[model samples]
Target: MSGIILHHYATSPFSEKVRIAFGIKKLAWQSVDIPPVMPKPDLMPLTGGYRKTPVLQIGADIFCDTQLILRELERRHPTPTFYPGLARGLAEGVAFWADHQLFGAAVAIAFGAFGDKLPDAFLEDRSKFSGRNIDRARLKQQAAVMQGPLRAHLGWIEDALADNRAFLFGDAPSLADLAVYHCVWFVRERARSDALADYAGLNAWADRMKAFGHGERSDLDAKAAVAAARAAQPAPVRGTVMPNALGLTAGAMVSVTPDDTGRDPTVGELVALDAQSVTIRRSAPEVGEVHVHFPRAGFILVPAKA
Candidate 1:
C-alpha cells in the first residue's frame, strides 16, 4: 500500500484527471502505460473485466472508475483536498454532467474531426466498445449536431469562471474544476483546432488546471505491475456487512459487469458488498489472488451463472 500504481496511457482525458489528482496530493506513483483500446491483456487480470483507463492500484486491491479512485486517494492522502464543503456535492454533480453530457459531446467532436485520419481498425475497435456502429460519415454528422450544445456548455463554464475566483469553488481547485477541465481538455486538445479558441475565460481556467500537472511518475512494465500485485496480499475489507438488497452473500460467486457497452463481466468470489461499492476476490496465474473493487453505480453484480 506504500506505493501507488496507475494503469493508464497518455492522451486519455480521464487519465489526466488522476494524474493531476496525484499532483495535487503530491503523491509518488508508478505509471504503467496501457492500450488506448481494449484487449488490455496485461490489465484484465487485475481489473477482472473493467477496462476503463487509469485504474488505481495499491498492493493487491484494484480500484476502477475515477469516482472510486478519487475517493480512495482522498482517504489515503488528505492534504490538498480534492473536494471541500458544498463543493463536494456541487463538484460531484458537475462531474456527473461532465462525464456524461460533456464527455459525450467531446467524443463525438474528437472522433468526427479525426475519424478519417484514424486507422480503420482503431475506429472499428472503438465502435465495438461504444456498442455503436461508427463511420466517418456518422461521426461527422454527429459532430456538427453536437457543436451547438457543446458551445453552450462552454459558455456556462465561462460564466461560472467570470466571478474572478481562481478555481471553481474559490481559490483552490475542486472536483468540479478537474472534471470540467478534463472534458474541455479533450475537446480542445483532441480537436486540434480551437474548439474553444474564442472562449477567453475557459482558456484561462484550463491554464490553471494545466499548471497543476501530473505528479512524479516513473515507468513500470505491465509484467512488473502484475507481478507486484501477485506478490502482495489483498487489503482487509473495511465493511462488515453485505447489502441484503442484492440477495447476495459474502461468498457468492458473482460477475460484475458495467451496464454500458463494455459489458464483459469479471467473475470472482464476492468479498464485500455495500451500497457504495462491491469487492470481489479473483485469482489468475498472472495477477494471483487480488481483490477488485467496482463502484456500485453503472455496474451490475449478478450470479455468475445468471
Candidate 2:
C-alpha cells in the first residue's frame, strides 16, 4: 500500500477536498471508512479527540484538518504542486476563506434544502457536532436566508473563471480550487440543488474539477489502519517551535482544539511547531505513539489545564 490511509466517510465535503487533491497528485491511497457522526472509536486513538472527517493518516503520523493535510501531501509529493503560480501563503489564504466562509454558506443552503429528509441520527449528531440545534425547520429557514450569501460567494468563483482559465490560479488546480470544489460539490452533488446553475463558467470549471476523479482508491479495514499505526513509528520531529506569544516549547503538555465546531481538545506533549502547523505527540494502546498535526489557523493551542 502507499501508506496514505484516509479515515473519512464517503459523503464528507472536507474528505472530498483531499480526495480530489489525491486525484490531482495521482497517488494511490488506502481508504478507512469512518462514521459520519460521533463515537468514532477507531479514530480516537489516532487523533486523541479531534473529531473531524477525512483525517489523513500516514503511518503513525496523523494529520488533522484539510488545511494542513494538503500541505503535508504537497510536501511529500511536489510534482503536481497545489500552489501553481501563486505564493504558497496566498493560495492557502484563499483556501481558508473557501473552507470557512464559503463552506458555511453552502452547508446552510444544503441542509436547508434537504435537512428535513435526513435521518434523525444524522440530525442529532450534527447538532452535537456543531454545538447547535439541528432542527429541520430552523435549517430550512437558514437555508432560505443563506441562498443570497451562497450565490454571492459562488459569484466570486464565477468572476475568477471569467478569464476561462483551466483552474482557480491558472493552468493547474491549486489548493484554492480543491477547497472551493468540496463546498460546491456538497451543494450540487449531495444536496442536488441548482445553486450553481446561473454560473455557466463556474459550472464549466466544476466539470473540469469533477473530471479529476479521486485517484486510485482501495478499501482497507479500519482495524488494519490502526494496526498499521501501531506497527510504524512517527517520522522524527524536525525544527524548533517558532517563538510565539504563548511561549509554547517542545515536550510541554498542551492541548489543540478547533476554534469552530467540534471543539474537542486533543491534549499531548508538543512535538513540532512552525508558522503554518503544529504537531503533538499522543499515545494510546490502540495506535501506540502517534504524532498528530493541526494547522495553526482556526485552532486554539494553549498550555493544558491542570
Candidate 3:
C-alpha cells in the first residue's frame, strides 16, 4: 500500500479535483468511500468533529480541505509538479478564485437544474451543511440568478485559452486547471447541464482536462482505515510555529474551523503552525493520537474554549 487513503464519495467535486491530481502524478492510492451526507462514524475518529468530504489520510496524519490536501500531495510527490514553471503563487491564486466564486456559481446552476430530483434527506443535509435553505424552489431561483455569473467565469477561462495554451498556466495542467475543471465537471457530469454550449476554447480545455483520468485506485473498508490509523503514529512535527497574532504556542489547546460552510470545529493540541498550514494533535479511543492538518487561508484558528 502507498499508505495514501482518501476518504471521499464518488460524485464529490472536490474529491474529483484531488483524483485528477493523482492522475497527473500517476500515484497509487487506497480509497475509502464515505457517506455523501452525515453520520461519518468511521471518519470522526480521524477528524474529530470536522465533517468535510475528501479528507486525505497518510498513516496517522489527516489532511482536511482540498487546498491543503493538494499542497501536501505536491510536497510528498514533486516529480510532476502541480505548479509548473514555479507558478505556485499564481496557480494558487487562480485556484482560490475557482474554488470559491466559480464553484459557488457552478453548484448553484447545477442544483437549480436538478434539485427537484434530489431526495429530501440529501437536500436537508446540504441545507444544514451550507447554512442555507436548499430546497428545490430555492435552488431553482438561485440557479437562474447564477447563470450569468457562471457564464462570466467560463468566459474568463475562454479568454485565458485564447492563445491556445494547453493548460491554464502553460502546456502542463497546473493546479489552476484542476481547480477549474472540477466545477465544470460538476456542472456537466453531475448536474447533466452545460453552463455554456459554445465556448469553443473552454469546451476544448475541458475535454483535455477530462482526459486525465483518476490514477490507480483500490478499495479499502472504512473499518480497515480506522484500524490503520490505530496501528500507526503521527509523523514528528516538521516545522516550528511561526509568529502569529494569536500568540498561540506549541501544546496550546486550540480549535480549527472552516470560515465557510461545514463549519464544525476540530479541537486538538497545537502541534505546528505556519503561514501555509496548521497542524494539531488529537486522540480518539478508536484512532489514538492523530495529527489533523488544515490550510490556513480558508480556516479560522483560535484558542479552544473550555
TM-score of 3: 0.98
lDDT of each: 0.84, 0.92, 0.92
Q: How far is candidate 3 from the true structure (C-alpha RMSD, Å)?
A: 1.0
Give the per-residue lDDT digits (tens) of candidate 3, residues 192-247: 88667778888889889888889899999999999999999998889988889999
Model 2 clashing-pair count: 0
Write the residue-wise lDDT of candidate 1 on 89-191 in tens digits. Answer: 7787888788778888888778777778887777887788888888777888898898888898879989988988788888898888888888888877767
Q: Can you list the residue pairs that collide in candidate 2?
A: none
Instruction: Please give me the total number of clashing residue pairs in predicted model 1.
Output: 0
- Better lDDT candidate (2, 3): 3
By the lDDT metric, which is better: model 1 or model 3? 3
Clashes in model 3: which pairs? Answer: none
TM-score: which is higher, 1 or 2?
2
Q: Please count the clashing residue pairs in each candidate, in the order shown.
A: 0, 0, 0
Candidate with more favorable, higher lDDT: 1 or 2? 2
Task: Give the residue spans of candidate 1 off by over 4 A.
Answer: none
